[model samples]
Target: MLRALVFDFDGLIVDTETPLIEAYGDVYREHGVAFDRAEFERQIGHASFAFDPWRAFGAGADREALEQERRAINLARTERQPVLPGIRELIEAASAAGLRLGVASNSSHGWVEGHLRRLGLHGFFSAFGCKGDTPAPKPEPDIYRLVVNALGCRSVESVALEDSAAGVKAALRAGLWVVAIPNAATADHDHDGAHWTVPSAAEVSLPALRARFGG
Candidate 1:
């Protein structure tokens, strides 16, 4: 039986990833430096990649002030970030069906948990696993493994919903069935490693998912 459902918190649940890229780009623009969206993309859902925009912009600018502005821009953007489609329905359905729900992310615990709480989605998760809770996060499978254990479910008996290449890779590596539900920011990410790549969050085939996984 599919006893659990694990979710990736950033791009999957909210569009925080896009705003982060935009904020960084905004900072670069203020410094008269061209921002490489592709460069920022590498850092999504994994901490293994580097994304120091000031380095690209030159060192003359006040790094602390620029970082503060970037943080403000990002916070403003995320204040209005919409929860992606079908997520609520999926969570409600999972809950009604007695499936354990979890959120595992490469982000810090405060970031993911705080947003979920603000959105009133925090109450739905049985487990919240993030970078601090594990030795490694996405692209390492440690976070996913920790969440599955916390949910009291076998890896094979759970499904992971992800939006980025790193997250998909992590879930797949953890031996869980992975579903890719890309948002605008992650639309171009490579999801070939996922078990199923759906067009968008709304079109995710939960029924098909269950049948394929013996739920």
Candidate 2:
């Protein structure tokens, strides 16, 4: 039975990836350097992909200042975005269905929790497994294992909602049924690995999912 539902935070819960990439692109524009969007997109949903944004800057560039600027832009842009369509409905449906709700992410707990709180969604999830909670992040099963165990759920009894290829990979590795719903930033990713692929969260139905996977 599907006893739990786990969600990926960034692009899944909110479209933070779009604003994040835009922010970096803005910083690069200010410095007259072209941003490598494809390269940065590759880092989405990945915990430890080695790529530096400042490598394009001059030798004397103040990396710290650039980081601050990027953060500010990202925050400002992110603050303007509303919760994605159908996410609230899904959460409400899962809650009413008596399934444990959790978050599994490659992001830090503080980052995930803070955004959830700001979005008035922090109270919804019963468990969270983030970067420091495990030795590895998405594309590995560590964080997913931590969250499912925390929720007292067997991997096969849980379903994961993910927006990235790496997130799908992690959930599958952890043995959970996964639904891939691509957001603007992750729409180009290969999500064929997921058990189901939907254009948006609006298409997900609790009864349908339970009927298909809960048994």
Candidate 3:
């Protein structure tokens, strides 16, 4: 009897991560600097990471102009990026089971909301919580707390679908039952802390959730 299902946007909903990383890589390449894979991996799943390309590369690249180019590239790449497998199915299944739907993310409202709508998923959520909506972002429990409160559901009766370690940690801290479903970028993430870790989103089920942590 799970009352609600909360999803993490970005890598979990749509793979904006790959496109964004590619865009960033392009920007670095333009300046004759190779993108640092290790540093990029460390910054994944957290929005507050220091991403000053100039400081990292010791280049005189204009940050604003570089940002604009990166955005343009990302936008072009995202136009063709498809929603992840099992995402739509999960949403529809949850909706049909009378579960209130929500999205909690470390991304900005404009970013997450607009993308959700474009992907034809904005109307499915009863609540949408993002960076500014809470005091902090994922890896902090603020975003998840905001979503649970907005949906008028207790944390114990809600289920969270997350792809990254930060998202899983946040949901667990907020008392939600978490299902970790990693995407390519987050496949190496440590999900041992989650209540359940699944190989794919299709394995996330309301019936299984109710059996474990009822509504």
Candidate 4:
């Protein structure tokens, strides 16, 4: 039986991908490098720390400087970040159903906390696992494994909801059942190994999830 539900923060819980892409573009423009939206979407999934796009596309630009610029841009745009449709309802339902919940993300703690606070979801998560909280990020399974361990649940008794292939891979590698909800930019990515692929979390009623896994 599934005792906990873990989530990915960015594209999964909140719709921050577009703003993040725009911010990265602004950073690239300042350095005279054109940002490729397609490439950015393809590469900037849950494993962002593993493949920092600043170094990939910045040419001779200083990585630390570029990261600072990106962070500043993101912070400036945080007020405009919006929660994903039905995410709050899903979270509430899951909570009411007595399922333990947590978050695992490739983003830094500040970034994750800021976004979650903006969406009034900061207190919903039982545990928050960020990039620096683990030795490795998404696509490595370490972060997700950490969340499961923290939840005090066995991997087989947990479910992970993610929006990217990297996040799905991480959860699956950690031996948790994974539910994939691909974003508009990453909808074309392969989800062959996910336990289920849903169009959106809105379609997944809490009762249905509980019926499938809680029992």
Which model scores highest in TM-score? 2
* Rank order (by lDDT, best first): 2, 1, 3, 4
Cα distance off (Å), candidate 3, residue 80? 2.1
Report the Cα lDDT for candidate 2: 0.90
Q: Please tell me which model should have the higher TM-score, number 2 or number 3.
A: 2
| Residue 41 alpha-carbon offset, candidate 1, angstroms | 1.7
Model 1, 77-154: lDDT tens digits are: 998987888887788778888899999898888999999989889998999888778877678889999999999999
Q: Lowest summed lDDT over 10 consecutive residues: which window, candidate 4?
A: 43-52
Clashing pairs in 2: none
Instruction: Flag clash pairs in model 1.
Output: none
Worst 10 residues of 1 by lDDT: 48-57
What's the ranking of the predictions by TM-score, best on top? Answer: 2, 1, 3, 4
Model 1, TM vs. native: 0.95
TM-score of each: 0.95, 0.96, 0.93, 0.87
Model 2 segments beyond 4 Å from truth? none
Q: Candidate 4 — which residues are off by over 4 angstroms?
A: 27-33, 49-69
lDDT of 2 by residue, 117-143 (tens): 888988889999988888777788998
